[model samples]
Target: MPHKNLKQTGFDEMNLSPDVFAVLQTVGYEIPTPIQTLTIPRMIECKDLLGQARTGTGKTAAFALPLLSRINLENKRPQVLVVTPTRELAIQVAQSFNDYGAKMKGLNVLAVYGGQSYSVQLNQLKRGAHVIVGTPGRLMDHMRRKTLCLADLTGLVLDEADEMLQMGFIDDVEWILSQIPQPTQIALFSATMPAPIQKIAGKYLKNPEKVIIRQESDVTNTIHQKFLMVKNINKSDALVRILEASFHDGVIVFTRTRNDTMTLTKILEEKGFKTEALNGEIAQAARERTVNRLKNGSIDILVATDVAARGLDVDRISHVINYDMPSKIDPYIHRIGRTGRAGRTGEAILFVQPKEKWMLKQIEKATLRKIEEIALPSNREINEKRMDDFKNKIYQTIGTEDLCVFTDLVESTAKEQDISISQVAAALAKMLQGNTPFLPETMAHKSAAKKKGTKAEIKAKSPVAPKQKQTPARLTPNKIAPTEKGMERYRIEVGHKHGLKPGDVVGAISNESGLESKFIGAINIDYDYSLVDLPFGMPKNIFNLLKMTWVKSQKMSISKYAC
Candidate 1:
């Protein structure tokens, strides 16, 4: 096992506030991740800085903690401002600031972004915010409205700088930066250091300290990656079976939209597992509560979208399940990156439809990592783990706990019934075996048979054998049947009249459904609406679900193409 990075130090570790240290200790954060160790000191000193790190390396806290320490909590005006490319990310970073600053007295943090009621945001600013985290569009809106004043801003941070550049928000970001008071501190963090970002930093930052944390060359090595090639129909049953078989403790299940995050969480709860949902629509207070539940022992599973999960850290997380794989590579890393933290090995399980394999390739290429596939856990594995847990519990009870009271009661019952010691013990074991499934022998073969091929010499396990034309029994419930194997069409209302574009439709669908944008076929936007070809036989429930989905705040519905 590698040494944990959260506590590993770089500069003056002693400079961290006692409150910050208290929170870290209570949460079991031990070492400083490379970025945290290197960047915290500079940030604490209120120095201009640049940090380059991958998605999962604790960058949020590195900037958040020190910024909290540097700010004047006594001031009601926004003292520190952090700009992210998306509303989800802005919310996430603001929450992080809240988490780390909870121990600090009088600190106020607010997240401002579009897609939410403006009055509520205005009210928050009216109430006063010391730390403001917001997206560019919304920030510009606030600046233009003169509701937010930046002349007294003490610190500014641009997170995921490269993503801002990609989304064509660089000019806005630069303009925002240009308007900040000259004496303010500046910090930027990005996975990739694109030229445009560098130019912005070169022009704005003064004698900035730069820290680039090394990404694991062997991301695939530390992570156990595998995908099941089930069709859309049978996925729910398959997931239940897989969860039972793996016995994962703390799990994160990814879905595409806020509704689906709740949907999956409800499903998992019905299956008898404690679960929670995190999404853009969820209240910020509720989001923090759910994440806290997942971090503590109160909840075992969290179902969330990519945006809802930004800067999320839960050290006990044992598994990251891609109920729906992400289209973007960096976010994929970010999702799976939840587990396998602090040098502890973790598992990543992906569920892929036959059409989504290309996305797998794209993800592999993006991370410069080759993920090995493995067979889904078999029924036998599930039963075996159950038995193991039962046996371990029994052993632990005998080893450490006082059994005198129970033992005396058992003795009295045995005496009253005239039963022997062995029989009594056997009867006790039987009664204790409540809901656990008995390990069945043939169950192991069920999982093994699903594999394509297993190599004896291979170090990383290969993915389960790709589904072969496979039967309908393997399909997931929400997946619709193919209209045509390669292409299909559905109607929408936003075509030429609405000035709809291909990317707009794709983004809307992908954001709403877990399906990758690439899976969407030809899109022809009409005047009022448009028609799009998607995988055939869209699952009735999902189709019904998507019918109410909206793009540009317009209902996205489908019918047989009119034109």
Candidate 2:
């Protein structure tokens, strides 16, 4: 976010404490992001602020540095509370606080969120934390149980308020805001200011200083975005082909549901990948371990849901594969933003179904870039890549490791078998390959299609399924059809009155029913209920489960809606 033309320079100009400045210097944060440059000073002065900044624009550090600078490490009774939309962001913000305040003694920052152990949070609360970071639900739960004492809380941050609004946490956030003491300094950061967000700012934030940052379009310039058209059933095969053929330092494969993350992780592992799964359900310690593994080269691939991968920043991740496309454009941006960090080039590949092409267009329009259509990696390509990798592996081993014993064995074996040394070496390589062949068979069909031309090949390999019986479209008196081709509308019992948002319904249905986001269609919210379009042939078991799935403490009570 740093502007090259801006005259203002380092954190020193902001008159930050030496302790905070030293910690920043140690972390190599020489230049301030635009949000940080503007918001830090106001936060330090204990003034209410409203900052409009994107997630990756260093907003966390903007608020964290100033808050830590003014933190009373002696008292340690929840002096600052930061509420985020998701557990991943909460953990990230808490980590930022700890990293920046490392020089300060007796600094205890606690991150509490749903799916985490309440007993652990209670224990942490009893020990008295100087700062608390958590999601709205978990924070409200703790506050309701009288475990989180906010009487001494001096500073508060509502980070990503728009996300909270979109996730249907606005009511809970407002309740939390109403409970905070009148004198508490508040700072709210949101990427966009919708009417609801603006209303909240006017109501809860008093005389707030405003900092608006324009959205940067150049973030994705270094990332090559491409889309592969594939059937839902063929995604795994395509993914395997892509992984085998594409060169990447590290890859994050994005899936819609947590279960998909686990399922995909196992599949990749079975195929001999150093892979791990990250989701909301993963324990905090385990999540941190998985992320650290990805960071330290212990794991070369990560399969994660949108919520789990929210605050992820791994510079070594050279590729982001959207195994299942997101329903929203914002999430698509956030997912790809994980890569191309530190000015390194990256790639984002999306798997698109026939029905999801409209959403792809929406994403293209939102990002102001055309996502080039790319064919799935052919078997011949995979084989070539495998051969190259095998040769490289042998070369690296010869250069780095001692092969004297193996060389002698190969030589002796060749002499004993009356065979050439080359044959013996080839046999050893075959033995090393074992069940996994180094060079897989090339696709004869693909080669034939290619001979006919690129367009012909695409048509031949098109993901459209063979003609099958279609479900009769059900019509009511209103005579409305589902917005998309293969989706059917259904009613959910929670809506605007319950502070429902389209994302909440999508997330709930996907999480509870294991339906991928791309399968979800248009969502319309009403007063006390919402209508959503889902894939027409949802399994009965999933339907039954979703009928009782809870969102906002209310049962979904899903039923077919003719609208």
Candidate 3:
């Protein structure tokens, strides 16, 4: 099918069985992704298929559904073999098959990989498994020992083919493919089509139909990318500030090491964020529980290393924060790809140190987009946000909860103490606040003050005439000129005084308003406020939200520019 026509097809229209359609409905899958829409029909027709797609594109279901549909329950002797690069992926693929084939009786699926007990796999294989998902190395071992028989295998899949090649498992993959008997349909999926992966496809696949959904260096344009320059000592503080200043439903913070995951998790928890940690040190069961917690909204933040977070698919991940930048561009892409998935908009924030600016450039070059640099939120901003959140909580409780008992207690306490009821309530609130201060000291004050002084110097050197409109020539070197036609100029109450930069303004407005960065026009930062160009005819509600939004250390207070 043509790409455009395929994009219009839904999962139900892809010739899926009623049982599979029921399962898809139960799992709340309404539409098909690009890869799924094109690959599923070809796989269902028993044709060899090759797909090029990135992570988080719903590729697992694209292959799993067709494999499950082709399974024969009566003869369960490993009819399908799925080879992946990592154990986590193996387990995830096995779980997808199980979840999608929940109603299929006597359909057994097994995941075999290293670090797992051999006895468990042996017993499961002996009992009979309709499908096997495994890593290349372990699957090769099983095949050599005659524990896993490919004699009855009717289908084969090499998932993450490029990743397997990078891990030096291409030889093993080829050996395993050579072992599979004739007449078995093959499906190979990779994020990138390197020459090595292409060689494998040419050698093994028979008249394979190609489906390229996305390129590896490509990121969803819906994701707003931003970065912060922070010192190593101040990373924790900066992270807290960003979390407080931005609104998100579920967040994943990536760290470089396992120990960092635990450390950050503890710190975030102490700071009153609902957080969890996923690392290699944790048991598999605990990791599963942590992931489940994230999915169910029991926790809002997850701190994890790259290895531990592989094959993680959660639709609610609204933001991805790179606390420590990855060493390579592929991992960086994979990390942020966790969000901005399934056509939903998301945001990614990177914390870059002065020394790592080169690495930031590498990422930007690879992704083919500029990573907007944003200032760290000042202490005043964090305090105001916390106060607003606390007040909102109280208001929500009053509107949705029964407070008669609390009101009576307050009234009685007021009468007994010979004070007003309002005083009693104030005392109760103070007691509830405990020893924690409502506002903490501003940590970024020195930098903010220095920026303010610099802004004053610039203003004195080149002052704007009183009550005159600021033109493009009046903008500083750090500002972007308003070049788009029909752009409406709006002023926000945050600028050099608040340590605000042009990119900081762009990031905040784009993320909070769900406006694409392309639509966010030029930015002009001044001493105590900034001017930005945006598309005209914005909705009243969105304009109000933009007004109330917080940037560096103050509310945007957004308004149309008069001059």
> TM-scores for all candidates?
0.64, 0.72, 0.72
Ranking of all candidate structures by their TM-score, best first? 2, 3, 1
Return the lDDT, model 3, position 433.
Answer: 81
Considering summed lDDT, which 10 consecutive residues are worst modelled in model 1? 473-482
Q: Report lDDT (CA) for all predictions.
A: 0.77, 0.83, 0.84
Ordered from best to worst lDDT, the candidate numbers read 3, 2, 1
User: Per-residue lDDT for 116-208 in model 2, tens only?
Assistant: 667888888899899999999999988999999999988999988888887899999999999998699999988778899999999988899
Candidate 1 residue 293 Cα shift, in angstroms, is 2.0
lDDT of 1 by residue, 39-117 (tens): 8887888889988876666788889888887677677899899999876678778888888887888778999987556
TM-score of 3: 0.72
Better of 2 and 3 by lDDT: 3
**Per-residue C-alpha lDDT of model 3 across residues 478-523, encoded as one tens digit per residue:** 5456447878989898777666877888877876677899898878
Candidate 3 lDDT (Cα, whole model)? 0.84
TM-score of 2: 0.72
